[model samples]
Target: MMPLSMVASGETVRLIAVRGGRGICFRLAELGLVPGATFQVIQGSGQGPLILAFGETRLALGRGMAHKIYVESFMRGGQECQNN
Candidate 1:
């Protein structure tokens, strides 16, 4: 799995695992970032916060927080790949 921070804008990815303390994990879960959740990266790249869209909700995540979340990216052509 790859860190969420590595994903590019417009890419859709499924939440894999989170790497951090319990508090952080709980907070992320509260924001709908639990494993198996699929979301699109609306804004990423550079050092700014990432804008993620899932359903009708959008979450702006900082680089540090993004790095703590791992995800599986679904590539084009119906192929799923893990980039770590």
Candidate 2:
């Protein structure tokens, strides 16, 4: 598993785990970031907020918050990355 922040822009990734205190986890979960959730990284850089797309909703997650969320990036046709 890798930090959500490391995912490439425009790639769809599956949420694997969320690391942090209960408050953080609760906040993320409230935003629909629970484990097994799938979302596409709308935008990402080493700086600024990371934008994630879940269906029609878009959420801007701070870099620090994003780092605490781990994910598994998947390719087209729902194939997971073997190199991870």
Q: Which ten residues in a row have the lowest lDDT in candidate 2?
A: 75-84
Error of 1 at 14 (Å): 0.4
- Backbone atom clashes (below 3 Å) for every candidate: 0, 0
Candidate topping lDDT: 1
lDDT: worst 10-residue window of model 1 = 75-84
Candidate 2 lDDT over 2-58, as tens digits, reads 888888898898887788899988898898877778899999757889999997999
Tell me how far the alpha carbon of residue 15 in candidate 1 is from the true structure, in angstroms, after superposition. Answer: 0.4
Please list all clashing residue pairs in model 2, or write none if there are none: none
lDDT (0 to 1) per candidate? 0.82, 0.81
TM match of model 2 to true structure: 0.85
